[model samples]
Target chain A: MAGQPHYREAHPLVFVMTHWVNLICMIMLAFSGFYIHFPFFPGFMGVARGMHFFAMYVIIINLTFRIVAAFTVKTATDLGSREVDTDIKNWLPQEKNKHQFFETVKYYLFLRKEGVISAKYGSLQKMAYLATIPLTYLQAYTGFAIYGPTMKGGFFAAGTTLVGGPMNMRIIHYFIMWVFIVFTMIHAYLANIYNFNPSKIIFAWKETDH
Target chain B: MAQEAHGAIYDLLAVRGVSRRDFLKYCSYIAATLGLSEAAAPQIAAALEKGAKLKPALWLNGGSCTGCTESMAQVDTPDVATIVLELLSFNYFETIMAAAGKQAEDNIAETIKEGNFILVYEGSVMTGQDGNTLIVGNKEDGSPKKGTEILAEAATAAQAVISVGACAVDGGWVAAYPNPAGAMGVQAFLDKEGIATPVVNIPCCPMNPEWVVAMVVQWLLVADDDPAVFLEKTALLTKTYKDGITGADVTLNYPEYVVGSTIHDNCPRRGHFENGEFVSEFGSAEEAMGYCLYKVGCKGPQTFTQCPVTRWNRSVSWCVNSGAPCIGCGGLNWVDNNAPFFKRLSSMQMGGSLGNVQPGSVAAVVGGVAAAALVAHGLGMKAAGRIGDGPPMETAKKYDRKRMAKGGDK
Candidate 1:
């Protein structure tokens, strides 16, 4: 575990900024998103809507940037090591993650007391993180499909008709919001369960060791 | 507190005795209630000025909850009490009248004999229990008359019939579910009886009293005081169902404007729906924050009514705005379509093992099958001992069960 990312190189400066952008966009999305859902007051309709649409585009852009960086950036090659390798391989697995899927689930369920030993991230974590990419895009798709001017677009309209009606499409859009919410809770808890070291590294862009 | 509308005209007749100021004020109010601009005030004033005595009216009740009458009572402007006294001779209103028994039935008979009166029908026409679901009786006659018979007799001599509320227009809740009393609307019942009078439908649960008053004023004061104009405005959306016994076209048609657009078109939360923010749980932060109720099952997207704008309680508030989602009470077959309101769609009346299942659940289950297949593929890789290796597969063993028993030779 020498040269372990317990100190530096765990997160680069660009990755840190993108993470901040993601967090800010999520907060804005959840807040203004609710305001636009039901206007509690008579006015503020225009402001809430602008904030919602603005934050939505920003989050989308940030997500795309995050994906590209996943391929290009150099980060830790192992869970605790500062050695840099291709980011995708560390995010996923080396050759070791293939047989570890059930073992990871078992570790969480307490079926296997100790955590599954692996190269970097566990299989379940990899799957969950990968799943979020498509989910975010799906939320974006459903959102645009229900929007008025944008809804008239061919692709969004295709989503509309494929779902029978706008109401049905709207429901899909609503439920996906729930997915993000639940995902955020688990993601935040899992990342913070160990220490603020990961948080300081990604958010503050400062190295911490304990 | 105000005077009976056109009470002056009745007062002038000497026999009826009503104040003129009360009469004109009621006319002014009716003019306003009907959404006629201020210009119509003088014309309304002139109509009531000339219209004296009364237009004899037959108010019949069928299989009903009397909610229409209750709704009418709730009319704050020009209150229904004034409209009845000022414009029409309410000879018989069963639920409100002090008259009862043989005398009551006789009064209805006399009203019909007048021949030029207006007919206001509430509730649904009942045909079940051998036509005994609703029976009109007089103490002296000591025998009940079928409701269908009464409607037939009333419609025959009537100049025009007004179908008020969902019940009179389409049998309402009395016709919901099994519809045991064989409930049918007034128009259908009279159609079977062969009555030729025009019928105008005013919809909603109990209907807006203003709409009914509007139709009445149009017939009594405007449309050149012609009865046919009543049918012409509301004829587009209604379908006439034939009444069997009387062989009459008793069904009336309704206006499309009030029901043309879905509630979502005018809903305030509709924007939230488009934005994809939703209240997944009742009383949650999302709900408190006023997010879209679509996820908590708002039928506004499919329901047709001007409720979002027109609202209820003198424009105080409506269902969606009040945090309760729409149940689509205004749509066709509303109970059947809008029930299980907390969910996206209707549930089957299935029992035990087959019980209610949502479309979402069905889709998830079908997706689960695909997930299971993927899991099985993973298992197939494991059994072939391809774990630390990639899934370029070879079906290594199970086919050689006999060779396992002869393993010593191998």
Candidate 2:
């Protein structure tokens, strides 16, 4: 802790805002989505549906904004360094990240005693983060297929038919939510495992230097 | 001659105690149901009355319980008996026809040889045990002519095939999971056999007879007995589905108005649904209040059928009106897609003894397992002393190690 350095350059102000939006939207969407699936209590369906749809749209927009910001925004390319580059460079596979995927897995599993030296994000982290984009869009697709208004469109209807029926489409949507839940659980644990420096910088925009 | 024939129709209607006005009114009703203009009513009347020779027809039955025939019989306007007996020359009708045994068998043969007859098929096409599941008549060798054999012969020669009821459309409940009988819809069978006759599908548990009547009249008046014209002139929605049995693509035609919207979209209790007033249980006070059946497993939201507009039993009362949740019999593969009928979602048939399982239960189990695994992994991380400040960091990258092995820093 005495020798370590952390700075605001790791996660700039705008990226922190988008991260908060993502966190808040995901929580609201998951809870509201569960309620819409089965209204355990009365009189909340209307509100639950409204909240679910609102969060869905917000999350999609926030994700798109985050992706676009990656190209324009600049951030620290390496930990403990103030040198900056467009954020998209850090997201791309860097020379330092080569062959680090299995090493990171080994370190997490306790099979290796030391963590892997890598770029801004380890290989596993980058892949998981990138996968969320398509998975979120797929969730939207499945949602629209079961929805009454948009379901009749040729594009959605064809997807519904391809999945066999509306019921099957609903089941797939339910399963994808579980995938997100699992991903979030692992993400939160890993991000905070090595103390809360990542969270402090991402959430509170604070810097820690010895 | 045409005038004499037209006069004979009114005289026949008078004999049946149906006034000329009532007859014309019935034609107008059919015209409206077919989405035709008011002027088309008189044209329909002319086409129906100028029946010097009635269009030949054969009403065939396959793997069925005769429910559709019973439903058709209950039609009060013009009555199905009059339509079958007088309007169309139904040379062979297994139900409500006097001809039977050899005489009835001969009628089918004669119609096939004659050609140009409309084939109204009821029930699933049985191809089980290599087509021995349903036997219609004996072959010339005194063995047995399968229902599949009879349907193939009749469908091949017919100008158009009208597949009446959900059973004839997509095998109904007969083709449900673990379908031991190997039943399938007529169109799928025809596709497998390479029969080129265009089929008009009227799907429901027993089907609304009005749709059948509208199709028949449309065929006579608008299509001029041409199958191609029938498809072109009618407002149809065509969808190509893979045959469940043979895995072959089969295109089916449904009347757009019939399968156009979900039953819930036109349900009388839709106000209750939007208002969140639901009938939670059968025989409850809420049920008496006629609330929406969505909570009680009404498949109306997913089922596409105009049941609310065209009520069953001659527009008396449909499934929801009678306080029963819709079982979604109008949809394709309805039983498998909407079974465990009282629940919101369908149960998945988990083959063998596993039986039907709810989708929610499976999701709950998977989520539970995932949570438990995450907790155990957390405990493992704590035991490994990797929870605080994490593991030691590698000073050099894995690639740097190779560079160092090749002698010193890169």
Candidate 3:
């Protein structure tokens, strides 16, 4: 038993709700945002705009709630660890996930096999996740800064002036959306690669107990 | 048949020395032109009656060539439509006003101070050189008066500001790229200064007089005793495209009904567009056939304005109908974004190092590069023995263990 690598199980309820929220929010945001960007049909403009704005507010609220919950919620840390950890800490790095960037790269490049695996996340994964938090906030900020009433306000006015004009700012916002799209694509593909377990836990909220 | 109405028709005909019958006939024709029902003739006749006593309107030339105001003089049909101006009073007009600078300025100031006049503003608002770009009249020292200062004073006490021509709406060609002279349209400039007074925009290179007439009629329809009240109501409808200085919002807040659809929607030559008939070259047989200008880069598809229905030059011809492709002058930042008039789209302004890249082209190129890079990386992964086997486990673990037992924390 001492020789066995530590493995931890996540708190089923909080994780279940969070996973459902994230999946639903991301889907709703993408769908409604696209509809607002261009009305594919005529009758749906008002509806699409309503949905887009509603989704935006909902996603923002959900994200805020999720971030706060991360501190309180205990989730799995290591694949083989019995020690529980704060989900945010696990999502970020502990003392362990450092200088592993190139090593992970080398492993991906097939330079090394049986790469070091310790915590719940590898360095690369942690970074990609952390990076998304800021990028998401930035995308939202840019979006708000281009919004009609918001753009005229002093808060957004500074960003608009800095970027030259609203058009340029809007372009930045658009390009950043593409970044999120690519990120979501890569993320979904990577998460589902090993098995369907992650998808079950995250999307379907079906916890895998071993 | 040509003339014969009451005081309204008589006054209009009187301006050009036409007889009473001729005046009434002209009134009927004008009523028809304005798209009014024939039954509205007596009502129109009554309005003209009240209109004939009005003072001459002032047409002020700012940093403009007064082309639009000049075009206003060209409004035809025995010039009776113009006699409609006799309903109100015009104390001064730059091109034809008998008064000189000081006299014109004084009279306009008096009229505006009384708060009973139509202020017609022409040309771009010059903010370059601290308003030194356009000097309307000289100071006592014989130096020119700043355009901005004069504009502020003239605008503050006016009943209404009618911004004529593209330049007055935005900097126009004069305010093109780099906007060295800091030329901006009347409304945009006014917004910057926090002047909330309403402005009616009549757009075009020089602008059409019919639009002015329509606006005048619209104003007449909703004329109010308090200028401020009228201004407040019109300002609601007079919203400007906030970012015309940049081509961010392509369409300004033009009347939705007028610019709601593209010229492509209402073009007389739309049959050719669907038929795939195109004008390959200028003055070609296809051109004579009035083929669609889409292939030739007609901006009609992207442009929104009532040019097709409104036409130009006495409704005889317009851009596409005249064999000229649409240049999208009605678009915000029209000149900067729509010029290189011969081309379908604005050309990229090339500079050193970076190659000239159009917006659409840049998007395509960047997309292509990322796709190519992804494919190449995928091939590299396969070649490196990483495709079949997952990443190395020992190294990844070693890395994780090292992080878990960290030394220095930031």
The lDDT per prediction is 0.66, 0.84, 0.63
Chain B TM-scores per candidate, in order, are 0.73, 0.93, 0.80
**DockQ by candidate, in order:** 0.04, 0.49, 0.13
Report the number of backbone clashes for model 2. 0
Q: Give the TM-score of candidate 2.
A: 0.92
lDDT for B347 (candidate 2): 88
**DockQ value for model 2:** 0.49
Model 3, residue B49: what's the lDDT?
62
Docking class of 1: incorrect
- List iRMS for all predictions: 12.5, 3.1, 9.1
Candidate 3 lDDT tens digits, B168-246 = 8777777877788888887777667667666767677777665666556545643533456554443232223445443
Clashes of 3: 50
- The candidate scoring highest on TM-score is 2
Badly placed stretches (over 4 Å) of model 1 are A1-210, B1-38, B48-52, B74-81, B84-86, B138-142, B233-252, B268-293, B308-323, B348-357, B369-410
Ranked by TM-score from best down, the candidates are 2, 3, 1
What does the lDDT come to for candidate 3? 0.63
Tens-place lDDT per residue, model 2, B1-410, is 22344566776777777866677777878878888887787888887875526888999999888999888775456653264236778898888899989989999999999898999999999998999999988977899999999999999999999999999998999998877889999999999999999999999989888888888888878898788888888899876667689987777899988988889889999887766678878899989999888877899888889899888776789999999999999988989989889998898888779788888898788878877877887788788776766656778876678778999764
> Among these predicted structures, which one has the highest lDDT?
2
**TM-score for each prediction?**
0.54, 0.92, 0.64
lDDT of each residue in A1-210, candidate 1, tens digit only? 112245456677887888788888888877766555444443455676677788889989988988888899888756666778767666665665656677656544435433445555667777788898899889889889876547656788667656644555665775677667667766765565445566777777777653
Q: Which residue pairs collide, candidate 2? A: none
